[model samples]
Target: MTEIPAVENAITIRDLVVDYGTRRILDGINLDIPAGQIMVIMGGSGAGKSTLLRCILGLKKPTSGSINILGTEVNGVRARDMHALRKQMGVAFQGGALFSSMSVAENIQLPLREHTRLDETTIEIMTRIKLDMVNMLPHEHLMPAELSGGMTKRTALARAIIMDPKLLFFDEPSSGLDPSTSAELDELIIMLKNSMRMTIIVITHELDSVFKIADHIAVIGEGRILETGTPEQIRASTNLEVQDLLHRKARETVVDADAHLRRLVGEEE
Candidate 1:
């Protein structure tokens, strides 16, 4: 019998919590994203999905708990250390956050220009390579406003990978696209995972894209992680919330008529 090697996680989060004033946005999140795999985090609106992403990306300071990315503790990490760690991470924002002033080629090369002292010729070559990878080489000279939504997303993805990051994060990758376009993007994501061997974390609520691209799925609800497993496991989940999410069923709410009337009348319980 052969022993299987233990899986290595690119990102490990434990008891992650985030708060805003007196309200808690995330509660006790514990997740391990395996290296070189695609992990999709899905949830209904206001379910703390975005909050978790922000915490992992070091944008939000968690009120408590720990986040380790690429073996460096993100929580309370030194500024210089976090800066270095960021060089190995890439993020594609929800809106394809491209600068309207820059051409596609220039946008893709921005990271190299900012971080490296490589010569112009090398930067141009790298930019071309990344653009080619995402099939946007022809549109390199086009402006952000001149491109279609799908093109804009591809350009953003090209920019994200130009530095060959070890970790890639996509926020709502399939948002605002037609089914055909979304499917194409899904294929591109899988290709990147296989070719680059990078750990990819995708935050989305689109079920089609989630099932198509995820190697693992983590479902979040009400500021907590409800479940995490493979797509099949998620589909077969017995959790009512998970089932409701899958089937687009609304969660049941038992409203107390007297309490509702009291609240409407500004009366205390």
Candidate 2:
């Protein structure tokens, strides 16, 4: 058997907690994502996967604990410093969150235009390079609404990698794609990891994609992690919650049906 090589830790979290008023979204979470590897976070709907992604992206401040990305503590970094940190990161939003008013070339050029003093010729060259990398160069003149679902995703990815960010995040990469398109996106993800040497974090409940691309996976449930391990380890996990999520089975559908109905009827305290 061949032994896998270990990489340095790229993102580390300790005792992470997030809350909304009295409702807790993440509870005492801890994780370490290694450099130059793909880490997928999988969970059922409302299982706090998106909240955790937001916390990791510095979009939402956690209620407590630490998130260290590329050696900088992210809990309360100054705005100037946060802006600097963001320049090193990129996010591919779910549903291909491209600008409605911009062409593919324009959208991909937006970041380089805003962040760098690079001239038009250089910016256009960079945009073309990324568009080619994502196999979207042919559609650079198209608008967001004119692209297919997979094309939209690839275009969004082209924009994400335009700056060659050290850390890249993707949310629901294959959410609305057909099976073949989803597999193609999965291949593209693996190629990005192998060729770019980027520390990638993906948030998805898609089991097939998770098993296909994740070097390691963290299974989250109800604001907490049930297990974190390699794809094989996760597949072999005996934890009920992990199994439930992987098999798309609800863990507790009627645990409190009468109380839930009473609450809907305004009869509960």
Best by TM-score: 1
**In order, how many clashes per candidate?**
0, 0
Residue 235 of candidate 1: its Cα lDDT? 94
Per-residue lDDT of model 2, residues 55-159, tens digit only? 888999999999999999998899888899899898899988899999999999999989999999999999999998888899999999999999999988888
Off by over 4 Å in 2: 1-6, 249-269
Model 1: residue 87 alpha-carbon error in angstroms = 0.7
Candidate 2 shows a clash count of 0
lDDT of 1 by residue, 194-267 (tens): 99989999999988889999999999998999999999999999998999887772222235788878989999
- Tell me which residue pairs clash in candidate 2: none
Model 1 bad stretches (over 4 Å)? 249-269
Q: Candidate 2, residue 207: CA error in Å?
A: 0.8
* Predicted structure 1: lDDT: 0.91
Query: For candidate 2, what's the RMSD?
Result: 6.8
